[model samples]
Target: MKAKPAKESLTIMNELVLPNDTNPLNNLMGGRLLHMMDIAAGIAAQKHSNRVVVTASVDNVSFKNPIGLGDVVTINAQVTRAFSTSMEVRMDVWGENIPNGTRFKSNEAYYTFVAVDQTGRPIPVPEVIAETEDEKKFYDGALRRRQLRLILAGKMKPDEATELKALFLSEE
Candidate 1:
């Protein structure tokens, strides 16, 4: 498979928190933010894989701050790493106060997606080339994250997770 720079898969989406998008407390609904993040991550995966992609899993989604009505929410996503047929997309969310001209980070999460053919069969995707230090760190940790997720899903054995083992069980 060909290798592609991680930046090639970057996707950004912006949304305004209208009354319809918020809860009764006048804060943006968590589900709405999640939907936005999913859309952004999906676009990134599709751009990187050049194939139809479907969400396989999501992890560590937590909101650090509330987004109020009239705020602009921006979600940024990028491919952190790519496996045989799946990719890990990292999404960062920010809330911008238009009136105050201030923006603050709200949350971040990781999403996994698998490329599929028209027949809905899994298909291989290009490898992600991490050019920046941060990208490289995420790319390196992808294996550990995959192992943990698989273990949690009962798809893999804890003893077989070499990447995770070395991470926490290493003598050094």
Candidate 2:
């Protein structure tokens, strides 16, 4: 299959953080934000793969800023890279308070998704082309990140992570 540009899988989702979605401190709950991110990332992965996709793993998600209640939450997701049957999606979340005209980055995360067939088996997905500088940076970093993930999951031996080894051993 022909490789698709990373932008082709870009997805943007917005949500209004209401009281129900907030915690006792009135900030948007972490779980709620994660749920939204997962949906947005899943959509991006599906767009890239052109097949049903399921969440395989979620990398560490760090909440940088608090999203207050009534704030507008915007999530931008894009497929950073595609492996044999899986894709890595990068998501950046922002919180906007329209009344005060303030906007801040709230969270960022990486999610892995596997394309699936009718029988729920993994299916091959199209590769991703990095056209822009930022895309190229993320695309190049994906392999190192994937190697670390596999190592942590016990799926790959540490010695076999050539990308990660190169990254750590390279003299800047």
The digit string of per-residue lDDT tens for model 1 on 66-123 reads: 9999999999999999999999999989999989999999999999999999999999
Task: For model 1, name the residue pairs that clash.
Answer: none
Maximum-lDDT candidate: 2
Worst 10 residues of 2 by lDDT: 163-172
> Tens digits of per-residue lDDT for model 2 on 97-151?
9999999999899999999999999999999999999999999999999999999
The global C-alpha lDDT for each of the candidates, from Candidate 1 onward, is: 0.95, 0.97
Per-model TM-score versus the true fold: 0.97, 0.98
Per-residue error (Å), model 2, residue 15: 0.1
